[model samples]
Target: MSADQRKSPTEPQRGNRPPAHGRRRILITGASSGLGAQLARIWADDGRDLALCARRLPELERLRDELLDRHPHSVVHVYQLDVSDAEATERVVERAVVDLGGLDRVVAGAGIGMGARVGSGHADVNRRVLTTNVIGTWNTAEAAIRHFWDRQDGHLVIISSMAALRGFGGAMAAYSTSKAAIATLGESLRSSLARRPITVSTIFPGNIDTAINAGNPDKKWSVPLEVGTAQLAAAIEAEPASAYVPRRPWAYVAPIMRVAPLSVVRRLVG
Candidate 1:
């Protein structure tokens, strides 16, 4: 089957779930740059309270100042944190929940990617990508889940990738698997929390023009950083279980992988 043949996330029907209010407190990880930074700006511009976290203190401080200057009435809290460390992740999240008086949304956006062969004796690169992309995301999501469980009203936006549409080849083994794990994690959470008021949306974006792709030869999938971020924010507002942003292109790609023969997939990956 081609990607277009697979199921897509449609608008939720017959429900009165309203979009999160502009004043809602939102927590975003990896907010130092790229998509996370864009999301932070988008939320801030909407007049929402924000808790931004990343490992870089200077960048976080500058972003905080920018947001505060732009939206004086909006509360912007900055935390310099490494989400890969579970303890630190917990501490920062605790402060965010308390300082913001409970989070209405959490964007688990802290992730890393690589273009190295797995098991090529590059232990450092493998560990860095896996830790930041998968484990870090897990830690952030777990913290958000706990907080949302308590409040019973919140949103979780987990960012996966289109590379995850199939096992990534061309020097992306670990990166692809990590994203695939993210997609599954979001799906599992969606199932587990079906009865709750919390909404979980898993976003699979195509090639976005971020630092992640900074040094690579330009590819056809590139979309500006803002485009992907805006699509994500819109997806959050739409509140579906899963979505392929820049839907026209990737919506066709996702389903095709599902029914394709294994050999064909391998060849495609090659």
Candidate 2:
């Protein structure tokens, strides 16, 4: 018999099938705490396998143990990773894929926020924020996309902020620019992979009570961590092109924020 004739119709053709959605094997960066950790918990509760990475080993391990205790059937791998390190990011992503059997989704959730006003002579602080938020996100995305391309099925989730809608002056300038860059990166990747099965989703979250914004009095519209992360996980699973978390105000607010005058922005956000 010819090789073509020997093929079974029941067997799926290579690179033709879309990624499985429910109970997915997911890898998340910055999974030690905040939104990342919350996402891990939500997925774990649903009996999904998770590969969690963060610089804080103790926190990651603790989270893993908690997940395992609650859902003994779930598989959780913990890795001490700093997404800013390009080489380490690649290596950890590959390792996670191996450990998880395969990857259905990757969340580039690692980020840092530091106050840096223009001409404040705090170049180091500004640089750190940019490196962690921009370079780190790029490193994670690059590694994840390479694997997704090989598998021809994967979802990439990027965590951006509502601040990305426009340029913010003062201490928020660096953070706003970094988040804008991330959103653009996700959008560009989505366009580049338009023909493929790979999915790219950028999440624009409004204020959430994560450690990053802890003690910040300026966060007027903050939601609880649980509420924000739950909504975020739903969006990530849906595989939408883009989303605004805590959709009520932010979904309505994002459009106006985009076209609002600088004076209005300053009054509203400042």
Please list the Cα RMSD from the true structure of every candidate, rounded to 1 decimal place.
Answer: 10.4, 8.7
Q: Which stretches of candidate 2 lie over 4 Å from their true place?
A: 1-20
Q: In lDDT terms, which candidate is top?
A: 2
Q: Please identify model 1 stretches exceeding 4 Å from their true place.
A: 1-23, 261-270
Local accuracy by lDDT, each model: 0.79, 0.85
User: Which candidate wins on TM-score?
Assistant: 2
The residue pairs in collision within model 1 are 2-256, 3-255, 3-256
lDDT of 1 at 199: 88
Residue lDDT tens for model 1, 30-136: 99999889988887777677788999988987887777666554567788899999989999999888777788889999888775786677868867888998899
Q: What is the lDDT of residue 94 in candidate 2?
A: 92
Show the lowest summed lDDT stretch of 10 residues, model 1.
6-15
* lDDT (C-alpha) at residue 38 in model 2: 98
User: What's the lDDT for residue 261 in model 1?
Assistant: 74
